[model samples]
Structures are given as structure tokens and as C-alpha cells.
Target: MDTEALRWFQLVCDGMTVTEVAHVHQVSQPAVSRSLARLEAEVGTPLLQKAGRLLRPTYAGAVFKRHVDALIHRLDDGLAALTELTDPRTGTVAVAFQLSLGTFLVPGMIESFREEYPRVRFRLEQSHDALGSSMVAGGRIDLEFTSRRPRNPAVRWERLFAQPLFLAVPRRHRLARRREVSLADAAEEDFVMLRPSWELRTLSEQLCADAGFEPRVAFEVDDLPVVHGFVAAGLGVAIVPATEGEPQPVGAAAALVRLTDAGAFRDIGVAWSRERRLLPSAELFRRHVLALKGGRMPTATA
Candidate 1:
């Protein structure tokens, strides 16, 4: 296979016009055209067809693109691993985490990590707590910080912290007068809740069910920031993990109250696949996580 030609073809598949790809690579249009012809000849099929002045990939090209994308991703991962192995301090670490980790855990640890390894680069992704476990399990990310622990046999976890759930409400709401609220009390009110798929939402629902009432959901959203906004706007109250205790919503009024009968709390942790060997950068992250004041490593699962 002509790796260079295939790479150029991949770029064209990614919405780059022939002239654009040529310009980026500092090659003439004729050179790019020749390379594409050579690639199509080698593959024994046309990869793209002209649609007016623009080129679009054929059905076969679409299939090839999926395979090529996976190949390119694996190659990139390999390069990243090689860079780490050659110079661990100068390589990049790709981490994915839920918002709470981004808001609370990463800021402090990233500062300390960068001070010790000044050359290390980090690529961070903030995802919902619901998807964090699956992202780690599928190898889409090196390390994941999530509130929900994976039940998958292929994944391993380390408990980082436990945060108590608190009722956040607009200050003018009737319930805002209370210092603390019971789960039963919360169930009676219209709630602005996390989407049902989220771990926090599942926990809230379970708690409400235990209280013998379904929560009256007035609004539903995925982000805590948005949830705070809705609650602050006097839409309804919600239960959120009290990681930093009380958080004041900007441009909105809200207060946090402890939930009495919501006996359970959410556990935030780092999860990674047990089947895959940890990359050097990922191992460094594992060390940093363990070093957190309340973090504890779990026993390796069989």
C-alpha cells in the first residue's frame, strides 16, 4: 500500500478539496491528482467521484474511510505511546472526565503535575458522568473520572472521593428557608433534575421511589451548570453532589440544602480498562490520582 497516497486520500475524504490538500502539503494539484489516481489504481476501485466541482467519496470510499479513521487513530495512539516511552516528561496525556472532576479535581492536580513535569502536555475532555465509564471501557480515552463506577468485567476503578447530595433551590423558593430537606420533602416539589440516564439522576429517582413518590420533574438537563441556571431562575429545585459544598450560580439566585433521607451518596472515581496495558502517561495519571488526599486504589479485578 502507498501509505503517503492513502494519507492524502484520507485528508480529501475529510472535506479538504484537492487544491486545499495540495496547498497544505506543498504539492502541486497535478501531483495530488496523480497520487489519487495511483491510490485508486492500487485499490482497483474509484475512491471518489466528482459532484459538480466538489469531490465526494463513493459508498466504498465511506467504508474505507471508517477503516482508515480507525487505523489513523491507532497510529496516533502508537505515536503518542512512543513519544511517552522516549521522553515520558515531554509527551501528552489524554484524559476524559465528568464536569465535577474538571471543576474540582483536575485544576489542583494539573497545577501540581505540570510543575513537576513541565514539558508534559495534556488533552482533557469533559463528558457527562453517564458516559465516562463507557468512554474508558471502549479505549476512546486513557483515563476517565466518573461518578458512576463501571460494572463491566473489563474495567477497573479507584475511588477518589464521596460527595453528599445537596438540594439546590432558588433563594425565593419556599424550601429555601429550610437548613436541610428530607427526600420525602423534596419528592413533593417540582424538581429540575438531571436526565434519567445520568448516575445522579438514577440515584435521585431511586431515592424518590424509596420515599414512595415519583419526583415531579419540571425540567431536565445534562449539565450541572445548566441545572444550576434553571434552578437559579426559579424553575425548580434539584439535588447535586456537594463537591465544593455551596456553589453560587452567577446571574441567578440559589442555595444548597442537605438532603436528609437521601441516605446514599455518589462516589467519584478514575476508571480504566484492565485488558489494556497502561500507557506511560496514563500510569503517571494513575499515580497522581492515588496521591489525592482522599483517593484510594482498588484491588485489581480478575
Candidate 2:
């Protein structure tokens, strides 16, 4: 049915004369009268009746007006909800990252962002880099933090920081006392690493290959802290990242030595799908992260 016709019917039924409704709507009296007639014809019933000089709604007209009123109310509510969803100060952002970032990098970034947008909320997910990038491409996550660029063409990866790889050794190990050591120096040592599914694991292997020997895998672990514990216990030495600003503590159990090899760094970055439009809150978060690209990201204490 024509909504404008129904609106005219409602106005006339509320005791307004046809001439008055026409003047209020800025239409001619004949145009308003024709619209009412069309509405009556469509409904096959008289919706308005003349009572002296004013018009009043018939039973059918009153029922239709109530339904129209409800629809209008719902439309208004939907519009308001859409506005809030896009508003930077009132929206939610969903982000995904590798488990390693949870300890230091992600938390600090979130805290800083919340300081600026106090009303914004977050839904955070921790997963391995591959799955995190897949979530972003699938639209399950608005953004992702990963150690390497995603292979998916739909996702755009922006480099945020380049963290140098470090050699983690037991405190009693000979190389632990060195300020910097070459990967070749520990070629014979057993290596503890993240599972093969992790990007860091692949990067570690590639670095070993570049160092001219394959690292003998002693054990595979998923968590960075567990890797640290194993290295501290002298089970194995691992290649780890030196996150900017956050240094790995050299305790009696373990020490972190810088890798002397040139270009031995992992590029940490943010990824998002190009096909999906980000909410205002997500966009703000993206801009904030991009602004920090020139700066350093804190690494997890191994």
C-alpha cells in the first residue's frame, strides 16, 4: 500500500479537514482528496467519514493506522541502531592475534586505545597466525596481528614492527655470556620451538637454513613461556624475538643473546580483508595501530 496515502488518511482521521491536511502537507486539497479516495478503493472500505466539517477514522482506518505507527517506530529504531554501530564512540571492534602477543603487545595497545575511546568495547581472540589471518579473510574478525604477512589475496597486510630474532640459551651455556652470537655457533645444539603450525616456527627454520645448517628439533611446544622454561632448564636453545622496548630478563636459569646475523628479524603486522568495510571503532583502531608502525612493539618475555 502507499504509505503517503496512509499518512494522509491518518491526519484526516485525527479531526483535520481535508483542506487543512493539504495545507499542512503543502499539497492541494484536490490532491489530498484523490489520495484518500485511492486508499479507500484499495482497502475496499471507507476509512474516513465526515462528521460536521472534520473527518474521523472508521474502525478499519484506526487499525491500519496502528500498524503503520508500529512499522514507523521499528524503522526509527533500526536507523538508530545502525548509527550506533558506525559511531566511533559507541561501537565494538573484534580483533584476533597470535597467542604470543597476548602477554604484552596486545594488552598495551588495547589499553592505549581505550584511553582515547572509553565507550568502545572489544572482542579479542587468540589463535595461531594462520588461523588468525583466515578469520580476518572470512569476516569473523575485523583485524588481526600476525608475525608474517598472510598469503590470502583478500587480506591486506600492513607492517607494524620488525622484531630482531634472539638466541635463547641456558645461563650456564658458553654462548650465554656473549652479547651477540651467530646461529652457526649453536648449529649443533638441540632446538625447542613452537609447533610447525606457527609462523615463527617456519621463520626459525628458515633462519637456521640461512645459517647453513638444519636445527635438530629436540621438542615442539605451543606456548612461548613453555619454550622459555625448556630453554632455561637446558633442554634446548630456541630462536626468539627481541620485541622493542620489552627486553627478555636474564635470570639465573636463562639468558637472551642477540643474533649477529644481518636481516634476522620477523616482520610483525596487522591484516584485514579488503572486501569488508570496517566499523568506525575498528577503523579508529586500525589507524591507531598504523600510526605506531614506525615505533616498536613489545615482545613477550620468553
Candidate 3:
């Protein structure tokens, strides 16, 4: 069961004399012999035998060596991988981001990071949780590029920037020609919205309230693009983000108008679990992402 015994048995089987193996290991020949004896005893077979003058493995030892070789090889590889994971420039980082940011913001940041740390590998994850991403708190991810700042104390958030929210309406709509409009101006219009669980939906509702009118809900969808599509189809109007970091593309059927109201922009940032220590690679990548902000403070309408 001792690894040293198995190793000695393997070496002896590989044609090394007990004396030679002991000399190489700086032990007595009897020590090597004892190790071989214990190994054969444990395996319940004579693994090594004297063939004329050279020491060699028996058929059973030859068969067992293959399994031992594989085990040792895997163990060594695992140790190396663990060591590599701590190397800042050559380690792996696991990153998670909201689905909306995947189009531009998150990917652009990752691409820029890889340019500097080409040797570093990344594991990417995407989440659509509308109530604020919880992957960090659960330690499922090292960092998350998200729009809503997490409310969990276990998760730390950094304000990167704000994505300005825009009102998208059909090109033929009365307010479509306007470059900018008040949320109150469209209060009576039927609204195309993401599900109520979505953060943007919550924001739209609050902004509508501040504007002194509740948006009449009409169509509900799961994704921003779909919400935009509904607006373009004249199903209803929807609030969307634009002219900012990786804003979703608006189709020609829909026109985006800037909103003139308090808190019209959503804060986009990164979240990480404070309870877990990030590997050197991930920590460095986090720094790289933060630096991308270029000292820009988040803007809020309210």
C-alpha cells in the first residue's frame, strides 16, 4: 500500500538491480529488498524475480505496472494543473455575465483581457436571473458582469458605468419623430415589456410612477430583442438601453428616443463573492475589467 514500496517494485521490475536502485535512492540494498518484499506481499504475487543476473518483473508485475503508471500520471497532471491555476498570466478564470451583455460588453472586455493575457484561459457562464445575479453569492462564478448591483452582502459590487435607457416605439407612432421624450408623455400608451421579474421591467415601472402615470401593460416577453420586436410591430412601446456599452441593436422598424426623466439609466457593473478568494489569474482579470472603465463614474438620472 506504500507508494515508496510500489515505486521500488516498479524500478526493480524495470531491470534495476536492488543494489543499483538502493544506490540511486541512497538506501541500503536490504531496504530496497524489504520494500519489494512488502510490495509483493501486499499484491499477493512475486512481482520481481532474479532472471540470471538481471532483475526483472514477473508477468503479474508487468500487468500491475500499467495501472500504477496511469494513476501516477494522472496525479502528477492534477498537481501541475493546480499549480498553473495560481499563475496570474497563465491561469484560468471563471466568469459569468448576464445574457444581455454577451452581445458586446462582456465579450469585448474578455477579448481585451485576452490580448494582454493570451496564455490565460477562461470559463464563461451566462445567467438571465432578473432579480439581480446570484451566481456570485453561491460561488458558482468568480465574477459577474451584471446590470443590477447584487443586494447580497456576501457579494461585492463595483460600479462600472450606466447604460442609458431609451424608449422604443414603432416608426409610425406619434412620438417616434421626437429625438427625446418624457416618460410621462407616453403614459397612456400600451407598453411592451419583459417579464415582471426582469430588472428593466422594475425600472420601467418605477420610472413610470415618478412620471405620474402607470404604463399600460400590453405585451410581455422574455428578452430585450423580443421586447423591441413587439414595439416595432406596434404591439406596444418598450424601454430599452442604447448609445452605451454594448446596447442591443434596434431594428429599422423601431425608433429609439432618449428618455428625459429621473433614473432613466441602469447601472452596469461587476459582482464577485467576498467569501471566496479569487485565484491570481481571476484577480488580475478583475483588475483588467475595472481598468476598462477609465475612471468613468456611473450616471443616474435621479
> Judged by TM-score, which candidate is best?
3
* lDDT (Cα atoms) of all candidates against the true structure: 0.77, 0.83, 0.82
Rank by lDDT (best first): 2, 3, 1
Candidate 2, residues 1-302, lDDT tens digits: the string is: 77777777767766788998889989999999999999899989887877888888888878877887787678778889888779999888899887767667887787778888989888999766542346788888998887767778998999887778889999999898999999999999999998987778888899899999999999999777778889999999999876656635434367889998877888878889899999888999999888888676533333
Candidate 3 segments exceeding 4 Å error: 1-8, 16-46, 245-247, 250-252, 294-302
Global local distance difference test of model 1: 0.77
lDDT of 3 by residue, 96-183 (tens): 8777677777767777778789999988997764885478788768988888777888889898877788899999999999989999
Off by over 4 Å in 2: 1-77, 131-133, 247-253, 297-302
Residue 223 of candidate 3: its Cα lDDT? 82
Error of 1 at 189 (Å): 1.0
TM-score of each: 0.66, 0.72, 0.84
Q: When superposed on Cα atoms, how far off is each prediction in RMSD? A: 12.9, 4.9, 4.4
Give one digit per residue, the lDDT tens place, for model 1 in 1-302.
77667788898888889999889989899999999998888888899998876678999988888888888788889988787754768767778877755655666666777777888877888777763345777776778778777888898888877778888888888788898788777667889987877878888888888878998999999788888889888888888876552334456577888888746578877788889877776678678777874843222222
Candidate 2 positional error at 274, Å: 1.6
Local error of candidate 2 at residue 167 (angstroms) = 1.6
Q: What clash pairs does model 3 have?
A: 263-301, 263-302
